[model samples]
Target: MTSKPFNKFRIMMKSLMVCTALLGTTFLAKAQTWHFGPKFDANYSTMKGEGIKNKFSPGFQIGGFAEYNITKHLAIQPELLYSWNSYKKSDDFLTYYVNSGRSAAGNNVNLGTVSVPLLLRYNINNFLSVLAGPQYSYKIYDDEDLIKEGKEAFKNSEVSANFGFQVNLSNVGFYARFNKGLNNINDIDDRYEWKSSHIQVGIAVRIK
Candidate 1:
């Protein structure tokens, strides 16, 4: 049986897919103004909450992005990404888990997820632009650092706000973004709330 949170995440992803298809159909006539590219990124991410330490962990993302230019200065961009997000466990947390018989527990929380970010881009010049948007992430992999008694320790789906800027030089673009979870991700308890955040620095290569 699937977990309730996982089921809910699947539903949300399906809804997002339908909406994206409808939008694609509507904008097919203007496809000439669209651009597509592959993106690779390195990130430093950490989970923040009542009990966990905030030590950052290294991660990465591989993905593609599509953009529709609405004007010389404005565009809509959507990205599909597969990312590894990691957060380090604190000394105290590790000690507790070790005492509880989970002696082999890892020192970091490793999560693999697929994410979609719909952003509005504002170009200030040919080489620079600012972007902001909401990102949807659904977890597909977990290290289970927080799991206990067969119960999930985190929510399967997360909503985040992303803010950043990009620099373009011909077909190569470089960017940096900050992502912050907008909702509590702690599924195990009500006393200690959890939120995740990450910083990404990336390079994008246009293919179309």
Candidate 2:
């Protein structure tokens, strides 16, 4: 890669690290009242746009989170995760026309992302809480094959909203959430805007 793109990547990475460090500092300030642990998430994801196929593509996430209690009924939680997903493109107009002589053999893309979510939690009861937040995600890897086909590559970063409910039992929790993209990731064409959507189901274990 050129120095320009490499510098951009470095800047983005530094920004993300700074944000994580700030969150950790806040957690430490409330160390006596904070709890943290690891989490695992499974995602069924899809995209919507012109000439796009929407399907439930599978993805996985692994990460850690910290919760700081502000009151009996309110808390703030922040998470950092590494996520991976695979999506398929079928019957695309550009694909069909670009490879007129050849057969359509493969059209799968794997994406790796670094995700950060800062959530505000409202405790509805002892066993349940509702969370709403904004998530920041940066693409770390994208399938080169898809990019070579003149397809529009996904944006380097994405911002989205997350709404979910969690059920807690002692130190373990189960959650289900919907992630809705707020910005168009499609830069290839101006006719249609592509947005992402995901269904996330996950389990979290509090170790401290």
Candidate 3:
């Protein structure tokens, strides 16, 4: 009779141990599912022209992004980024100097901007996500040599909207974003416009 009671006790203890082990495994898997990390980006920027040949100007960014999983299909991402943008003047000045009565000056301008973007991300699957959001940018520095003569300053601050898509791996993600400027970049003259629309490719790591 004592042996029968002891055997029942043993069975109960073994079941409890299995339950505890399963719970621990579930917690570990949940912890590994969420993460945050730093990012680096490289991009190209150029002006839109009609009947003008445009060249790609190189740009880059470094930043950090955080992601929270709301479900298997939805997420929220916010990022703080430092971005550099470059633009070049048209060759019309060269044509003016050769054919018309003017001197040609080549102007290649670069602007440094600090940007913060809040994006809403929708996951199509484990490997792909689409993002769109508003971005605010403050001018940190500008190349004076690139500005036209008599201009006090180029456009310095901007607010814009961005849209992009991301490709995600287990712990790493690659993304491409396009920013469309809604504010004038030049603060000196209203007639002189400084706007930006560029495509950036970046890598992200998950920390959590």
Top TM-score model: 1
Q: Rate the local accuracy (lDDT) of all candidates.
A: 0.77, 0.76, 0.67
In candidate 2, where is summed lDDT lowest over 10 consecutive residues?
96-105
In model 3, the number of clashes is: 5
Tell me how candidate 1 scores on lDDT: 0.77
Candidate 2 — which pairs collide? none
lDDT of 1 at 135: 96
Model 2: residues with Cα > 4 Å off, grouped in runs: 1-30, 95-105, 149-152
Give me the candidate number with maximum lDDT. Answer: 1
Cα RMSD of predicted structure 3: 20.5
* Residue 70 C-alpha lDDT in model 3: 85
What clash pairs does model 3 have? 35-208, 36-207, 36-208, 155-185, 155-186
> What TM-score, over all chains together, does every model reach?
0.80, 0.80, 0.70
TM-score winner between candidates 1 and 2: 1
TM-score of 1: 0.80
